[model samples]
Target: MNLDTPIEYLKGVGQQKAELLKKELGVYTFNDLLQHFPFRYVDRTRFYKIREVSADMPSVQVIGRVLSKEIIGEKQSRRLVAQLKDDTGVLELVWFQGIRWADKLVQPGAVFIVFGKPTEFNGRFSISHPELELYNPSAVKQGNLTLQPVYNSTEKLKQSFLDTKSLQRLQASALEIVGRSIQETIPDYLRSKHRLLNKADAIQQIHFPQNPNSLEAARHRLKFEELFFIQLKLLRNKLLRTGKFRGLLFGQVGEKFNAFYSDKLPFDLTNAQKKVLKEIRQDTQKGIQMNRLLQGDVGSGKTVVALMSMLLAIDNGFQTCMMAPTEILAKQHYASLEKMMGQGFINMALLCGSTPKKERRIIHQALQDGSLNILVGTHALIEDEVQFKNLGLAVIDEQHRFGVEQRAKLWRKNSVPPHVLVMTATPIPRTLAMTLYGDLDISVINELPAGRKPIKTIHLFESQRLRMFGFMRQEIAKGRQVYIVYPLIKESEKLDLLYLEAGIEAISREFPLPQYRISIVHGKLKAADKDFEMQRFVKGETQIMVATTVIEVGVNVPNASVMIIENAERFGLSQLHQLRGRVGRGAEQSYCVLMSGNKLSREARIRLQTMVKTNDGFEISETDLQLRGPGNIEGTQQSGVLDLKLADLAHDQHILQEARDAVIRIFEDDPELNTDKNVLLKEYFLRKTPAISWNKIS
Candidate 1:
């Protein structure tokens, strides 16, 4: 069978089996079959006697003769008991609910090789459900043994007689095809410099390694190619964006920027804020389309920098649109910007999805007539019906909430794609920044504003809940607002929300005074209700806001001075930090209370300890990246974060840097991979994979 042929065309695969394989393993093509590498390997070459087995070891292999085999119970819950004896000692082999088959296979006085984890039960050593292979004395004496590969299988596939062995047979057939069909993808120079193996060799070694060194070499080669293609795609997009798109040339318009800082501003800009603003100004004046990412910790003054850039767009007589992920955030930006720029400094309009049709029509007419200077909204601003008069800049807040196509729609609203400025409160690790946002310029606001007190973070066990409540009462008595957050919005399949509900009910019981208002917000609440609840908190009408992570992104309450997160162990470090950021915005001395349960894992304890030690977002992000790895740093699919299959953004930074350098060097020498020896390299990128769509990359 050819690598490009349908998988059903392979030997011994029928229609029903092909459908099951496709659904269970995503194997529709021969190429897919070849790439299904084993999760782990079991070495049969190292065999230990029964007496040499220890309880502390994970697993062991033994060869012995079966002295007796019997069923211990009724047919429903029967167990097979086999007593095996070796020259050293006798061992018991047990299998649950499969006695009939075990009885037929293992007869008295028959020698067999068994492999399994040894466990101590009732003061006796036993191996439960050990895998058995009939022993051949002559073959065993020859020392001819192999490593057995284990693959992840589903229940349906296993029931259909497509277990690991069946899958291995299919893989063996596919590998034979790959050996003759597939070609090497890396150029000779790169392969030699990196000491890499060919594609076919790497695939074979990864599945059936001769030694650990071979496995390492196979892994390195595959990971390098995966990362190289990702970087190349990002770099190409960046090059196309800068070379093709036109941006408004607002050269050296620091007068308006200075005016806003000197006359209209309320607080002094932090050094980090100043630096990021300068970067934005330079990008705006360069006349090239600005695809920049504004990354900072929560409450690091990203909004102020965004507003300053919007003002620059206004000064250049070009209308700007700022899109927020939610209506509450959009409204918050509208109120804050109006307060900063005065009522009529710029004609600002809010065009949300829920905006009345009459108001939307008015906003649409004003935008097309060049009357509205600034517009803020949710996804409504990107509707095709909404036209812009010389749209110069598009600012997206909390960029992780939107996809690439969604952002591109906003750009297409204008004649030429508007200069894009994406902002996020989530601090991205440096390595992930290189791979995910390689097409964008990065500006980080690492420092908080002056006079803003650092939020004191502390972790308390669940047993200390009462003391935490008492402390909360004291903080409330001192006239400071509090935010008590839960990790879940409601009951889930994986987790119970009983603790969260109990905490909310307990707070209500303790603080029953009508004079003190308590508001609730969660994902299950309707959008309008959620917005109203947040508005109450923002207006200081609610002294305590009980919420879930729905408030983690854009609910700005400067008056809220305390944040209490229940079951903090359930959250990632970055999430805990973001929730803690809800407070400490005001001039008050804010505090974060992390309540965790007992018996936290080592990684969980480290995450909590990191939260208690510092408030720097960048440092916390680095710690989070190291602890959780990059696969989960930005969450999974629908999270707008790049999903890398092999490259660990935390551990693969050096590899990514080298691959980026190589790509740059190649382009500098030859714009296209058209050289005689580089042909294979070009063909490799054209091949499709499960993680990335070919059309998206091409």
Candidate 2:
């Protein structure tokens, strides 16, 4: 049978069985049937004598003859007790709610090989309902027994008579077909160099490992191939992007950059930002389409670096557009940029979704006629009707929020594709950054701006709420605003929203005087209402704003100095950091109070400790990567920046770098993967990309 052949077309698989297999195991094709690897294996080679069985051991197999068997207890909670004896000692076997089955399986004076964990009950050794196999005296002679493969199966499948044994039969059938049809993908030299196994051997060993060493070798080969092909794909995309798209050469606008650095700013820009800006300036002037990622901690002067890039664009006689995810953020950028550039020198317009028709018409006309040099907006900037005069630079904020298509849409705004600069306050672990943005050049603003004090982060239990309240009161009395954030958007049937609503009500009660204003915002509130509350907080009308994660992204209030996240254990590390970022925006010594619930897990404690020790987003992100792995760096939807299978963005960073280096070497030598050895790599990419249609060039 071919790889694509239906399972029913194979021998012994009937229509009913095939449908059941498809529903239960997702095994529709011969290939799918062959690739269902076992989750674990039992080393049947080691057998423990009945007398040698221990209570603490995970599992043991023992041979013994049944001495007695009896059913006990009521109908609802019936149990069977069987006393088994070997030459050395006796052991009790118990089964709950399966007395009839147990009675039939263990007949008195019958020898059986049983496997399970042994426990001490009433100072006697006992096994609770062990898996049994009938012993045969004729097959007694043996060395080490073969390991038994344990495939993952559901109870429903077992009830339908499609248990592990049934699945194994189907697997045996597919193995015969696969043995004939499948060809080896890895070449010999590289296999020998990496000390890897052949594809067929690897697949077989993965499903039914002969030993632990064999399993390790098999895993290494498979994982390496998976990562290698992914790297090859990304490198190819990078090559195509860099070679084909030409960028406007904004030669060393160091004069403009230095002017802002040397004189204009109130506080000195960090060395990291300056270094990244230099890199960006060099890339923009090289006449190659610069696709660079500017990663930084919150309030690290990324905005200033982005502003310098825009200035470079303007100095080179081209217009720039900085797009934020939200209208509030767009307005924030517009205001900030206006203040930085001082109005009319570079005509900036705000063309958001909420922009009035008349104003939008004016903005559209201004954009088309080259009157507008800078435009800040949401997705409204990428609308088909919104044309640009000369869009040389496109700076996207919070890059993870936009997908390849969304970014590509903006790229299409300019005929030649504007040099893209994606910015993120969310510090992605470096390894993840490589896999996620392998095609883009990365520049990290690793240092905070000068004189910016690190946010003092503290963790507290639920019982310390009163102490936290008192601390907040002191902070507010010192003329600082406080932010109390909750995890929920609205009340749910499953989750209690008592903490959220209670926090709001409690804060309102604390500040009962009319002079003190308290605002409440959450996902349940209307967008306008949320915005209004945020505006009040930003304008200093509200001394405190109790809200949810909806305000985590870009609801900036520089004056707000205290952030208290309730039940911080429920939120991820990166998220808590983002919430913490809401404070520490201004020069005041900001503080973050992480109120956690009882029963903190090891990982949870590590997360809290990481926050307490460091304010570096990059470091926090790295710690997060180590803790959670790279499962949701780009989020769940396909629209997120990075989505990968098998590759752990956090743990596999080193591998990613190695793979990237390998790709570079391959390209330097061959340019295209046309060599005989690289054919498998190409084929591997072809096989994997169909799911994402990543192979299709558009």
Candidate 3:
């Protein structure tokens, strides 16, 4: 048998089982089934007497004879119950969901082995929906108990009689045929050096381990293999792209850049900003394609560094463009650049979807005529007609918000493609960044600018509303603006909007009219109306911006000192971090008030406590990863690069780092893997490389 043999042909996996496996688990061939490792394992050697079972025990295994079996309850609520007894005492075993098939397996006077968590009700112990099998002395060994693999299954699969035991049996059957035929995927020398098991042995032991030591060895081998391949693929693509693509060399800091540094600069560049610029300068001058990810916290000076980099491109006689996820943000960037650079000195224009046809026509003409030195806009900047004469640099803000195809369209604006600088305010953990954007060079501005105070975050219960309002009044009395944000639940936007509107009404009644102005924004508003409401907040016409999370990203008001997030427990750690970020942009002390209900879950309490503990985005991000897992972390989930099976980003950082280092060493010795020693590694990646569009990663 071969790895590619159809799973349907495997013993015990008939057509129906094969179809179910393929639909529920994505298993198509023997190779896929072999790779479907168990999520957890249960110890089978130790069996407990009925009296030993306690409610506090996690899961217990007991072997007992069935004393009585009967069906209880009426239709729909019907269930099967059996009284099981051992030498110590009697225990109740019950099944609520699957009755017919369960009735057949359970019979009076029959011996059985069962495993499940024990629960106490009415001074008696019982196990519900426990896994059971007919007790056979021949199947039991004389030595210590061994671990049994447990596979994840869906309700449909369980209803169809394909439980974890059935899956384990099917895997064992498939292994019997292909164990001898399987070949080593990793090289012999490297496997020996790393003390890893061979591919076949690891696969066998992972499914059915004989001991704890073998299971650990099997896990190490599989995790190492999984991570090593991912790192190798990422590094190989990076090397290939560097060799294939040539960039516009900005060889000198010409007049434009120099003038901007000396004349147009607002403040002294922070050490972090200076270091990032040096890295960008080096990449631009090297004449290799520059795809860099710039990460910073909320008040960090990323905008200035991006603007200065654009000046380097302009100094080299090439035009530049910046794209933001929202039109409000695009407009903000356009305005900030215009104010800082002076209008006529560098011809810049905004080309969002809201731009008028007449102005767009003029901007289009100037872009073709090589007069528009810089352009800032939303996705509208990538339109077919929006062409640049000499696009040398393209800076994307909140880069994860745009899809790979959308960003790829910007790259195609020029024949050779411009050097890309993708920036994000949501700080990515180092391990996540290396895996998600591993092909791109990463530069992090870890320090906030001088004189900016860290946002002081506090968690308050809803019962403290009067005190919260008093604090808001005090901040407003100090001539600082406030933001009151509400969450939008998916079940009902109208209900959420009603809550937001009610918040506005309550705030207006408290602050009362002539002395205060309130502006609201939400997803239901039209684009123009939303922009107008945002403008009112920016212009200080409104002392308070009462809105939903619509104001999460782009609204930047330096005068805004307080952000009160109502029902903050409903927000994720990342979103809560982002909302906290909205406040601390200005130089003066700012505060983030996380208003949650008193009855918060443990996870929600941790999120709020994390927020209250640190203002560092990276720290909050790591906590968020721990609390929510990598799949829920915003960009990594959608990137399709984090589909890890055995290697976890949170727990297995050491393995990931080792994998990356090994790839570097391998490539340093054999760049193309053309040597005889590395031929197996080359063939392995080639065989496993899926049709992934790596270009959109930037």
Over 384-459, each residue of candidate 3 has an lDDT whose tens digit, in order, gives 9998999999999999989889999998999877999999999998888888888899999989888888899888
CA displacement after TM-score superposition, residue 695 of candidate 1 (Å): 14
For candidate 1, write residues 1-698 as lDDT tens digits.
57778888888787888899899989898887777777777666688988898888777888899999878887667788899999999889998956668889989999988888898887668899888888887773523256666787899999998888888888887887666677777887889987889888888887777777788788788888887877777776666666666777876565666788789987889988888878888887777789899998888888888889988887777889999998878988888888887886778999898899999999999999999988999999888899998898899998878877888898788877788889998888888788778878999998888778999999999888789989888888888889988887656777644455666778888888696789899888899798889889888888899988888877777778889998888899888989999889988899999988887889989999999998888889888888878767763345433555456777877788888888877766755567877667656665544454433432
- State which candidate has the highest lDDT: 3
> What residue runs in model 2 are displaced by over 4 Å at the alpha carbon?
11-13, 17-26, 42-45, 48-60, 63-67, 84-91, 108-111, 117-128, 135-159, 162-165, 252-263, 634-647, 650-654, 683-698
What lDDT does model 2 reach? 0.80
Question: Number of clashes in every candidate structure?
Answer: 0, 0, 1
**Candidate 3 accuracy as lDDT:** 0.88
Error of 1 at 35 (Å): 1.5
Task: Output the lDDT of residue 372, model 1.
Answer: 92
lDDT of each: 0.82, 0.80, 0.88
